[model samples]
Target: MAMDRELVTCTKGDGFWTRRILCTIRRLVRLSAKSSTVGNMAVLILSISCIDGNLLNAFYHAAPSSEIIRQSSMNSTISSVIFKDYDVTVMLFHSAYLVDIEQTEKGRVMKLDSLKNGDIWKTMDVLVFNSWLWWYRRGPKQPWDYLQYRSKIVKDMDRMFAYKMALRTWTRWVNSQVNATSTKIFFQGISPSHYNGSEWNEPGVTNCLREEQPVDGSTYPGGKPMAATVLRSALAPVRNKVQLLDITLLSQLRKDAHPSRYNGFKSMDCTHWCVPGLPDIWNQLLFASLFS
Candidate 1:
């Protein structure tokens, strides 16, 4: 039941004014599953990592005629390329958080700063970001050491407060660094998890281990998470600078879409959705937003 292959496709037009259509198809092909043909096309099987690095590589490699002005290591947090033939400058930045946060490593805390400070925002024509999954980790699993506020360290703070502070910092950065007319900014809403089976109305079940179908409804029985509320409130001030892709409610119904036992029976994984599964739906929503 292990995930076998993933496919992602992104295309940029030759016209200067044309909007880029980046379609990421993260398909997890299981070997045992029956093959189905659509029209005259045969489904191609390719293997790659998640959306960030692999997607960029696929986009560049697909265009052999385009001259790559600059190319760097695959491991770098930021990557840029100038396509001479397409007249497009594409840059990708891996900003783990919108604001500065403390990271704990080997009993040492490290401070990470905002995306604007890195000078990457200035070059981006389109920026899409998601920063909810990491915030839920607690204790050793959480990388952050302590929350830093206004040049002072706080031993502990409400998660909502920390999230809002980071989001506001990001908005302030956007206000100073981004031009709303020229740059497109998007914030993906919080992705919901199905760890608690009671959330889906199956009280005895501990997690999404044996779930094979989504909760049948337009809304989740558990409603929304508190973090989603915090996110909406934080984005209020910067609604002009950024667009929120609210995918939470739709994604919440997809309890069967997670990796679950497909990853292995070792532990229940109800967090990350299966590639070519729920994430594809998210990308479609993202694509529609960009074009709209």
Candidate 2:
């Protein structure tokens, strides 16, 4: 029988979250014949934040398979693709938030909910989740009709409070539903951005635009973000159940690894990292945690 192992990574955006990890897995499989020989090939299933057909296409094409299956489209909530010979099946689900939260976009307020109701969680054997960057937005950039808590709805609440509440809901679902023995869960820690040059001791720079190297040190000059602290605090109760992939400090040093203007040039994108860059390291760490 083929050894079945499941891994899940939850994060926003198509950049550092999914593609980098996918690429790392693909490379590892290619390098190690042990993956197929030991009948331990990985079948990656994802709960995607948004639909990016191009990213899926790129992954499928780069993989070692002739019979590639495309089961859904951009508008669909779920999409599946199978790598015929490699025993890899990737399913992408559309989700913007880890828990039920109200988001406003283009004058329309949308309610983002948890994946607890979905059948995806039932089969999830390994899970990795991330949420940050989105929580910092304000005004029109921050898309939310109103903060929803139980029976109460407010115009706004403390970002940390909302984050902690959302995490509480998520942990509750995991504790109740997920099989602790069969499944392994991980939370990808807050990925830091290099928007402020002063954070890295360069005050004159505006953003991570033309920078081409990471900050030279083991520690970030500006120290960790309060979001990271909030994450740890929220996860404290459930830390035993879920492992935290602490990529914050390491990622903070990679100030120059962002897509910056190359992504669009419309605005500086210091949030997401460059593909064959820092995220690759993140995935390497993930791969180590999964197999080693």
Candidate 3:
């Protein structure tokens, strides 16, 4: 019994030092909110390591277009005050073909799956997990047969068994340390990006440029039932080990947040999010999960 091939390559994070991260996030948050200057200064420090450097284009390879927003998302309202007041750091990795996790090992890509138990988990205070949205896709041709898809999954591997191994690996690695309570791991539930506006019944635009993007915390369109269903099923094993950030449901509600209107071009991307909206909500929720 093993996970289907579609998701075999999509394994995301192996939580190692959970307790240490939780404490760090809590402390940083408390300290950052005490003073505006301290918070802003802390943001500068945290933002430096947050950079992936390999990112090139915003829509395509831009340093995880959502990273800046995920950070800024914490700065929006009282949440900004809360996050800035602390010295906590959220280390996350996101990309377009992340589901292709295996191919990552072959090149210069930063592979989240390659992380051993205590290896990189020791490097950060909190690790935000994510990976999905690309698994159920037929790539480009819309392999529209759902039954065929499900059968393909069952025939290829036993989904439950695959999850068990993944969870075992992650739990073993994360629980090995006593400071597990300080480390917190969260999985940003499958985020939908606008591939074509037609999926939402609003046909208009596609693609995004970093310069013309919206600020952090703004909502926009993008979602699909198939992707959500697949993610829900795949996330079953690590349910207790990681908090699921439900960005999929929220993104579906904010349909008008697309960028076509601001940039004057049909760039209403539905797959990934624009700044100042959804990604911020994701970050805010991550912060609240740590404290509350």
lDDT of each: 0.58, 0.63, 0.38
Clashes of each: 1, 4, 41
Ranking by TM-score: 2, 1, 3
- Give one digit per residue, the lDDT tens place, for model 3 in 102-216: 2222323222233332454434445555544333344343222221121132222333333333334444454454143434455556554544545544466443322233323
CA shift of 155, model 1, Å: 3.6
For residues 1-292, write the lDDT of model 2, one tens digit per residue.
Answer: 1111110121223334344545555555545544555244444444432113333544554544567777886668667777655455566655545765433453333222344533565454455566765775787776566766766566677877777777777777777777655556777788888878899999988788878887897988999998899889878877778888898999898888777887645778888765555665665676667653
- Quote model 3's TM-score: 0.45
After the best TM-score superposition of candidate 3, give how far the Cα of residue 140 lies from its true spot, in angstroms.
14
lDDT tens readout by residue for model 1, 238-286: 7987888898898899888877776655667888766545665655665
* TM-score, structure 1 vs. true: 0.72
Error of 1 at 33 (Å): 49
Clashing pairs in 1: 26-276
How well does candidate 3 score on lDDT at residue 3? 26
**After superposition, which runs of candidate 2 have C-alpha atoms over 4 Å from their true positions?**
1-43, 47-58, 101-115, 138-143
> Which lDDT value does model 2 have at 205?
83
